[model samples]
Target: MAKALGIGGVFFRARDTAALAAWYEQHLGVPGFWLQEAGLTIFAPFPADTDYFPANRQWMINFRVDDLATLITQLQAADIPVETRPDEWDTPETGRFARITDPEGNPIELWEPPAA
Candidate 1:
């Protein structure tokens, strides 16, 4: 049987699509049609009552980065609030993680997988 290859795109509603798109491009370096580097992509389905993300939102997007510390600093310098849980979220096996929200209140996860 043939299996799905990978995620083609992510679609969601935004109050101002143009502004939101630009914000992503400027802050996170994600464009409308991004050519992402090949890496691990997780496909998880959470329970309805899961509190991993905001209760008001149905979905969250995760993006893998090479340098989490630099990215966090850049985001903070741009006046964007970034949440990190080093003690609770980071590990030698999994790597570091950070969380941030878009202007429209969409949760975004930044992950840096452990080095090979």
Candidate 2:
């Protein structure tokens, strides 16, 4: 038997595909088929009725980062709104987290795992 190795890509439909793709490339430094650094990738399915993110959206994209604080600053500098509940979102085991949205209203979660 064989199992899935890892996610190779995340494809989605956008109203303005080119502009959306450029936003990701300019702000997140990732274009289609990004070469990410070695790190953990979360595979989770939230409850259909869960309010963890926006109810209107069915899926959310999460990315792992090295420094949440620095990244938050960078994102803020770019005029992107960032939201966080430090007490609720951070933990010794997991790490820090922040939320932001793309031009198309897709939710994105940035997580920085605890230092090893």
Whole-model Cα lDDT of every candidate shown, in order: 0.97, 0.92
lDDT of 1 at 80: 99
**lDDT, candidate 2, at 43:** 91
**Stretches of model 2 off by over 4 angstroms after superposition:** none
Candidate 2 collision pairs = none
Best by TM-score: 1
Give TM-scores for every candidate, taking all chains together and pairing residue i with residue i.
0.98, 0.95
Candidate 1 residue 115 Cα shift, in angstroms, is: 0.9
lDDT of 2 by residue, 1-116 (tens): 99998897898989999999999988877877777898888899989999999999999999888888998999999999999999998999999999999999999998999999
Point to the candidate with the largest lDDT. 1
lDDT of 1 by residue, 1-116 (tens): 99999999999999999999999999999999989999999999999999999999999999999999999999999999999999999999999999999999999999999999
